[model samples]
Target chain A: MKCWLLILLILFSQSTLSADFAVIVSATSGIDVLSSERIRDIFLKKRRFAQGKRLVPVNLLGSKPPRLAFERRILEMDRLNLQQYWTASHFKGVTPPATQASLASVKLFIEKVDGAIGYLPIEMVDDRVKVIYEF
Target chain B: MSFRLRVIVLMTVLSLAPYIVTMIVMGNVYRDDYERRIRDNMTHELDITNERIEQSFQSLRKDMAFIASLDTMDDLLTGDLDKRITNLLVLKKNDMQLIGWFDVIDTDGNVVASSNPDRIATSADSSGLFSVPIRSSFDDNQLGQLTIHYSFENLDRFLPESEHSHYHLIVEDQQVTGPLNTDPVISVSRVLTDWPAVTVTLEQERQFAFSLLNSAENLFVIVLLVGIFVIASIAFFVATIIVKPILQLSGTAESITQTQDYSQRVAINRNDEIGQLSHSFNLMINGMQDMISRLKAENENRIKLAKEKDRAEMLQDLSTKLSRYLSPQIYESIFSGEQDTTLGSSRKKLTVFFSDIVDFTSTTDQMESEDLTNLLNQYLKEMSDIALRYGATIDKYIGDAIMIFFGDPKTLGVSEDAKACIEMALEMQRRVRELKSEWGAAGYSKPFSIRIGIHTGYCTVGNFGTENRLDYTIIGSAVNLASRIEGQAEPGTVFVSEDTQLLVRDHFSMTPTSTFTPKGFSQPIQLFRVISSGVTRSEIVIEESGFSLKLDSQELTEAGRQDIKTRLLNLIDDL
Candidate 1:
């Protein structure tokens, strides 16, 4: 039975987590239903637009707890691993995502900046910042 | 290579061998470690790549599903297929690595839809369409077996190119659903059963080993170059310090030998074995020099001794000859070593006289041997005395004949020598007359007569000899004719040669004697008889006075006095 449980956990960990990154827009805004690939592209600076609107991506500081959790769940990168990744990114002149101090700061930035996108836990949901995609 | 260079190179090789080995070993270890790390990291990177691919596929699928679930998708599905294809074309154009999309096949093997009609070989075949059930909004009804083929290359944006395109996956296949390391990836298969048509896809992942080995190899090449340079420099320094001196010494020694300089010793300044060797070489040179000098000195001494001995032997031979034949007076005169007789020749005027006892041979014929020896000794002694007293030399004595000359084997003069000779001849005649008188008083009945001759002329007097011995004598025709004059005289006569009479023609009163053929002559010689009894030794008697001397009537007695008187007359005649 324990072997069965251990196998079950291994199987569970092997499965892709149903994490999503949303390229969200305001309810008053015009974009909807972005593909997770498009969201990844925009976050990684590989693309510049969602639908027709230019993407304005906001992020938390790399060392921030929420940022670490966000990268793990969405980008699927640990902090140490992300550090190495960004270090390589910095060499390419493709800066990692711009950072904010907190969820509040991200919300404030999203409200001010056009087409701004940010992420937070579901419980931190607010009306100001629109979640683009979730992972 | 020079010995120093070789030694330095060897030493450097020996010295650096360990480091070279260590570097090589470390390089290998690091290479392995780097390769291992790249592999381990590649595994994780590949996992991330797969997840991204899956994510991309899921998003593509969701987009397709959304389109299929859209009111337009249903409208297009029910309507012409061109509208649906146009929408998928738009989606495909959104990403670069993505090719055109395809629709899934149901279990009934029907192609529901596709972005590109060419994506399927045939509509009824459905071999390339996906048929797997995908999760959707309604778990009941099973999402109507909807499946979609994603372009699948959107993951390249996030992953490195080496890891992005070298893999493939099959999401619905359990054996290949996990992380992969190669191409033709199938992240999602729209198939419900094994026989269901499925979309086979490719993902991104390539081998990182090539780059890993390349970096290690590059690092190794660079390190090796640096290591070789460092080793060479160290080797050069070592050789310069250690081996150069020994080489110099060797060449120096070679030069010394070639130069044949045994005394050329090396001078090594260092306090080492070579220095000691140089010192020893100097000592050996000194010893050799000393031995050579000693030998040279000894050789020189030996030569000097040999020359001195030859000189001494010559002197001894000369001394022995001197002692054998020389009288004391002559020895002293001749061997004084300062006197020179070897070149003794002189022109001098001299008077020569010759005399012979008349019939002395017959007188000795009957005498006893003792009486004859006594008589000859007395005669010779008395005649020699008279010759010496008148400053004349007894030139020779031939039996009872006497020859005398005044002037020297030693002196050089003319007129004085002639005068002295005349005086001596007169004295000789006088002494003979006195001797005859004494013999008569002793009553020896065998009377002897002497004949006398006198001449005056220039003569050469010096030593004349054969190879072995020499005699000092006067040589001239003057001496020869004087002997002739003596022989021509009668038993009581004293005669003078014409040569003498000519010199004293007016000064001497001479009676012309008869001419006669003489011995050893082809012609006759004229002789003169000079009167001589009034001649005295102290008086310069003039021959023109015509003096005569009185004596016994025996011819021997009368000839003796007459010879004395004739010599005085000859002196006054001034020849």
Candidate 2:
């Protein structure tokens, strides 16, 4: 009975940790929040401008934990589905979001650029950027 | 040296000197030009190789820059997670056949994209053979760099390779491509303008670079040898042609001198100068032969002429001795072909003269035979000289008597001949008187005197003898009468017959004398004594046993008169 309780506690902490990521922008962006659909449209190049300003979107490279969580929870797509969607948008002259090789590069890019948006682990996000969305 | 050898040497030198000189000069020029061309060719090849290498590098840089300028490279701003720049790098590497990999490095020094998949997301530095900086398309800030790991093998395609020559790519003082030649006759290098640390070099081997010059030198030597041989051979042939005749000529001359024979001649076979020389030599020999034969003939003729001259001189000597036995008129007539020498006679009116030495027999009995002969010869010689002066032809000498006549072989008229004979008799008496005094002075008390008789008559005068012996004489009564008249003459008196006296009576004074008849005469002949010429002058005549004289004052020179007076005084003192 104790081993069962311990397994359940481990499972709960793992979920909490997996969900600790955010979509952030520069603090001076004057953007207060974003919805999942709007964030998806901007990342997939369906919406080129937001809040009367052009949006620049950035992503962590490959399948990082934050990138995977953003793709699954906000974009509502698996890794294969998201790649397929970008591939389809590619023929329409639409490109997927820009990518950084590390979470640090993603955080730095959002902090330095206005109208810039990117996903990072909640622990890596700094005060130089504002959190627009969380998953 | 022999003429042929000398000529050959001279001709070889003459023909080959210019050839060798020109060959050397041209060889030098050709070698220089060939070396220059070879170097120029090497340089040109190196230039082409350098240009190709440069062009390749330039094209690579341009492609890199073009790729770097692409917005696809802007993916470097997002770290190129989509592999957009990586895909482009891979494509460029394949298209250019690059042997090295390409990478896109971000400003953070991380390789975001790479042609080599293993290098993706790797940290990289911008150190490579070639690099192009990536800039942000939005603000032109430094983003990343497009870099290539350049392989020297890429330049190997432009490097030319051959057996004797090779090309090398030197990068930062290291040989990158192509084999390094250890010993090169020629080395050409060019540094890359864009890639400053790289150099292109061409190396050529010694054998390959100078092959043409070596072959050309060999050919020149061969040609020079052949030319010398040909020139020497031609010179030898020509020298023989020219010298053979001269040798033959010298030989002929030597033989001729040794043998002293001019009959030898050179054979003429050509019309060149040598042949002309032989012809002239033959002509000279012919002339010599002709002269020798003519001289021999002249010598023989001279010998024969000398023998003939000797014989002619002997005949003349014989004729001269024989002439003493004949009268001058008769000898001249016979020799001149006017008279024939045969026994014959002729009758003609002639004046005949006879002379006899007085007391010759008595004087001969009293003296030696030699003294008697000398006295008789003296008396006859004086009388004969007078007789010849009067144009008398002497018939013969009989002992102490002489018989002569004028007329017949050559004559005046009979009267004129008679007158000449009387005058001759008178002069003979006078000479006899003079000889008496000369004999007294010569120590002979008794000397010779001559009495002459002359007559004018007809006689037979001719040659009378056998064929081997002959005499020219007169035989007739008139000749006997002239002898009988001489027998009546005194020792120093002249007596003439009436016939002679009558013919000379107008020119001389004569008195009738006693007549005498001979045994062979039938009638007595009247004779006369001649005294002097018709011009009468003071004269003297004296005769004695030991003294006699006859003088004509009208004929005496003053000196002669003085001489006579001196002689008379001496004679009177002696008396």
Candidate 3:
């Protein structure tokens, strides 16, 4: 019975990745393409602003799929490893990114805030929040 | 205590003092420094281990990203279960330890397909993979799940030798069911975005034993050895410079005191306190030697002078006594003149007198020899004392006789000898009477008397006779005549020649003993008894053949010649 559970965990953990979080802007915004390194730098909170617009990196609720995906793809780390990394980084005076819950909330925050970056499935995205890059 | 012991103690203390100090300081410094160094090394080792562990994870993430971009994971994501299992089996064969599974979960959070389908059968959290409500690039209705559990070793190939691990996969929101012995592991999960199958979860174990042992062992020995070397050398140098000299000076000073010798000194050349002390000690010893030598020399000189003084006093006494035994004229001839005492003879005018005890041998036989000798010596000693008192010299003792003289070695005057001779005769008579009474009291024989004869003329008085044996004697006719007169004299009386009488004619009243013609003499010699009492030099009265003289006072006074002429003239009418 426990073996069946470990296999499920392994399969689920490998599939639902949110490493490629999207950077959203206004549909009529002037910003266009960004390199994979630039997107990584932005999602990892290395670059605070891009092209005179303040970049906001949003996080999913704890233990959520997109949050884990965002950590693994953008920050290139697992949830447990990221927790350890953030704990060690906090000791060095660095804080982790902010978090929110639900795809609806991600879309609402992205439409209202310029240069807002968040992660959701492509179906949940809207005209109000234009996708700047995809994972 | 002895000098050597003191020195030993001082040296030992000096040597040990630094060692003790070194022990104290080294103990303090090494304990703190070693502890601190150990802690710092531990911290640095920990930091390096942490960094290496982080690097291992970073490399694993990059590999996972690359694998996610591979077309293989995408195919595994969308393929049938059999196909995905076959594909993952190939991937697992490539690196079996870390890549535990390759599975796919549908948008309903179900494990639709998997390489290890049995391993994920009970995994309830399909949201850990790409299984939540999310839009695909083609449309908002497309959602998928992709999950990969790489083997522990495959996840991080750059794990250091100290960080090798045996792992157990931990399923999300599910119980771990693998072998428990595969432990001491950390489970890591990554969420993938573009290629859902790129999501990975891994378990790894880290060990830091090698780095800790290296840091602790090597650096401790190096730092400890360096600290000990520096402290030990400092301690030794300090003890030698400060303590060694004190010991040397004290030892040498004590040695010098023991021997009281100035020859040895501490060999110090520096201008320091101990050096000065050594210099002073040398000076003190030198001074002591000088003083001792000076006193010794002076003491020897004093003893020498005392011995010489004793000899000189003895010589002076001998000379004074010898002068009393010899006539003055003879003494001058022997001592003052060049005539050798070992040789013989000198010509001079001298008076000689000889007196003898009558029947002296028979007289001595009646009494003890000591008493008789004492008696005779007593008589002689008294007579000699009188003779010296009268300025006469004792020439020699012949049997019981005494020979006396005057005017030989040195002369007093023309009449001095005659006067001494006369005074000696009077004193002898008085001494003999005293001895007779002393002998009678001792119950001995009747005392004996000394008879003496005197003559004054030229004689030889010196050491004379055979070459082998010599005597200092008067050897002239004058000496023989004096002897003859001594023999003729009656017992208890002194006889003198008319030559002696003429000299004392006014001084003496004497009846002639008789004329004697001896075998060796051609002429008869006349002698007289020196009148001893009740007679004045102014008048002479005597009866010889009924003759008496009453001399006129003027006639006796006019003649200074004992008034013999007046007395004879007054008696001439009867003649």
Q: For each candidate, report its DockQ versus the true two-chain complex.
A: 0.01, 0.09, 0.02
Q: What does candidate 3's lDDT look like per residue over B338-442, in tens digits?
A: 446786567877777788997788777777778877887788788878877777767787768888887755467646777678768866876776677777887
Error of 1 at B145 (Å): 2.8
Indicate the residue-level lDDT of B540 in model 2. Answer: 64
Worst 10 residues of 3 chain B by lDDT: B131-140
Q: How do the residues B346-464 of candidate 1 rate in per-residue lDDT, one tens digit apiece?
A: 66666788888877878888777786687677877776776666556557778889887765543334444444444455565566667667777877666456777877777776667
TM-score of 3: 0.39
Of the pair 2 and 3, which is ahead by lDDT?
A: 2
What TM-score, over all chains together, does every model reach?
0.30, 0.44, 0.39
Q: Give a tens-digit lDDT track for model 2, residues A48-101.
A: 788888788887778777777677677878788888988998899776766666
Rank the models by TM-score, top first: 2, 3, 1
Q: What C-alpha lDDT, on a 0 to 100 scale, does residue B124 get in candidate 2?
A: 89
Q: What tens digits encode model 1's per-residue C-alpha lDDT throughout A68-121?
A: 545655566666776787788879976666555456556554564456676765
Docking class of 2: incorrect
Query: Whose DockQ is greatest here?
Result: 2
- Model 2, span B1-575: residue lDDT tens: 98889989999988898988888898889878887788899999888888888888888888989998876765676566456788899999999889889988887788889898999878885457778898754445778888998877888888868899988888889887877677746878888887788888888887779887888888988998998888888999999987899889988989999998888899899999888899999998899889989998998999898888888888778879988887777777888877788989889989888888888888888887877777778888888799778877878899989988988677888888888877787788777767877878877766777787887888988888898988888888888888888888876777888888888788887878787677867778888887776646467665555675678897999999999999999999999
Q: Which candidate order results from sorting by lDDT in descending order?
A: 2, 3, 1
